[model samples]
Target: MANWNLKSFDDIYSSIAESAYKDRPNSFPKLFNKNKSTEIDYSKSKKDNEGQITKGGGTDLPNGGKVYLQPDSKKLLEDEETGYNAYYVTDTETINANTHQTYFAIRGSDGFGINLPQIKKGNFKEFNYQDWINNDAAFALTDAIVPQAKYATKGMKEKITELEEKAAPNAKMDVTAHSLGTMVSVQGLAGLSESELNHVGKAVLFDGPDTTASLKKAGYSDEKLKLLDKKLFIMSILLIQLVCSIVINHGINN
Candidate 1:
């Protein structure tokens, strides 16, 4: 059994950065695949590393916005080879409207990109360890989204909400994200209504920050959702030490 260590913040950040879906299809398969087949090293984050996120919605929406499922018609996705805008090519296998087993895959945040037009134009700081430190510190201190994470969160919330709407009843929505995206997903999920939260299931976070408290914070204030009682299985990749960790249970009335 291997145990992935979160000793350095870089260890965590690098895990996510490497797992991101960039111009290459390099990272997604490993993240989405069962078992920890790939163990990425926590090398020092560099200014030249490939950015996983793609900017969308432009200035019309605050912070240039983010999109989870943009139509192929919009040509928002970038081509890995040409660096030109491209359309999303749907996988015929993922969606089956009539099937009994429905899996709604809701994407989380895409970490910042350096070559992206948004970054070049100076819309915000490149999402890196420093950025996370600043955002997390401000959030822990103020219980508010820092100016740095504000736009990022707004876009994340909007995209996640859209996916939630599509999921509806009888669909199991699983969230997958990396790096700052893990933070964005937690905040977005916490803001969801009790009904929406019901449709969501497990979330697989790669190299994420401390998210143990997120479940306790989710759901409507009036709803009695028992998320804390669920079993949390952490599969550490360094040695693949698989263990079931019980989440502390707490009732709403308390």
Candidate 2:
């Protein structure tokens, strides 16, 4: 029963992000089989009758832990409106037999790298320009919560409820995100009900802009905002730190 730490979540987030940019077959399998161990039971890795797992995809880890991608994961990745890409990962080792620890790893922006190549090849189907112009730009300039954040909120809640009914009872879910996905994670978590929030553990967000304004615009009260603050572990860049210092110093001088 090995519990994952923040570093483990960080690695998962990075791996998922990379998988979004690269080919899936080459990249996705590597996440579960990192050590190249031969102990995994491939025959038993198929999806169960409950449809909680995807057939031909779920894999057993070296320590007898099981991990699966939810059935709707492919649709989520192909979503153009929100550009929402996420993986619902479960670990059997961290909790009791009746429960498991679930991780919702949300990827950030697809970036020019993903879209530019599609444009060069005259392939508009996979191009994700909406993610940049609509979601990312909106977050940077407005007080309103980006549409992606709203989508994430709905997606996470629905998935959690679905899992509880179909997968396991009382499972603990943790969230991890990077870059623009951090906005999706924070604002999305803010929208959870108290009971739903209880099922959620820590949220690890990396190098994302502050979501205070967006949360406020989304109509979260100060009390609710403070509640979310307690669960967040944010890792911001030095540039943001320096800007904060300058603002604080100037305010003090005034």
Candidate 3:
């Protein structure tokens, strides 16, 4: 039940410095150079019992602009050799744009690496601690994703509540996710205030297998159900496109 509250850009960077991927598989070899770069020691993040600072802290995105975490990524400390690693990515170009900042938690297995599942980045923050545990991926899959469902649920609710608390009386927010993450996202959305729900532009989802039963019982209108079906199809196609790119990337990389 590891819970992370990423409040700043520094928080995201610190996690990456300590991640196992930096030294092992080292996915970004172009920057890390197969863990052989002399200028930077990825291992320093693991070794420093106290902590150290490093320049060029940002998540390299497929797009151009550099993403920063809340407290700076360098601030997050981890020891991958002993199984501790996490990171977050957030776009800085936009205003209050939580969509660009996504959280990731990676683990090592038997001297190998683990790829975290994709979790949707949102502005939600208000949380129901108990409900999150019940809906967390750790409770569902338990094998991979952590019980982050609560953090994510609370995060989104916070996002919506904060928005209403501030300006934008008419603006809408949406909650969406795939698989295990989807369960918590939807639960939080369901728990939002009616005004929050009204402000919710949409609740998009992808392969949220656990929530179908819930949605069915909630008794959505025919139109709402149709919209959900359409959204599902669109998400499925988008996933297929990404999956294809992954297959191609693997072939090219290997």
Summarize candidate 2's per-residue lDDT along 1-254 as a digit string, tens digits. 00111111113333333333223321232344322322222223222223233112223332243344443432442355667766555554322355566667777776454566767888777656666767788888886687777667777787667556755676677787667778888888988987788778778776788899888877789989988988888864343335545655787899
Q: Please tell me which predicted candidate would have the highest lDDT against the true structure.
A: 2
Give lDDT tens digits, candidate 1, residues 127-205: 4433334544544554543333333333334433444454333545445444444454455455555555555555445
Q: Which of candidates 1 and 3 reaches a greater lDDT? A: 3
Among these predictions, the greatest TM-score belongs to: 2
Local error of candidate 1 at residue 192 (angstroms): 1.0
User: What 10-residue stretch in candidate 3 is worst by lDDT?
Assistant: 1-10
Question: Which candidate, 2 or 3, has the higher TM-score?
Answer: 2
TM-score of each model, in listed order: 0.41, 0.63, 0.37
By TM-score, how accurate is candidate 3?
0.37
Q: Runs in model 3 with CA error above 4 Å?
A: 1-153, 166-172, 215-234, 242-254
Candidate 3 positional error at 38, Å:
25
**lDDT (tens digit, per residue) of candidate 3 on 9-96:** 1222223322313332122212322222212222222222223332222343222324333222232323322223222223332225
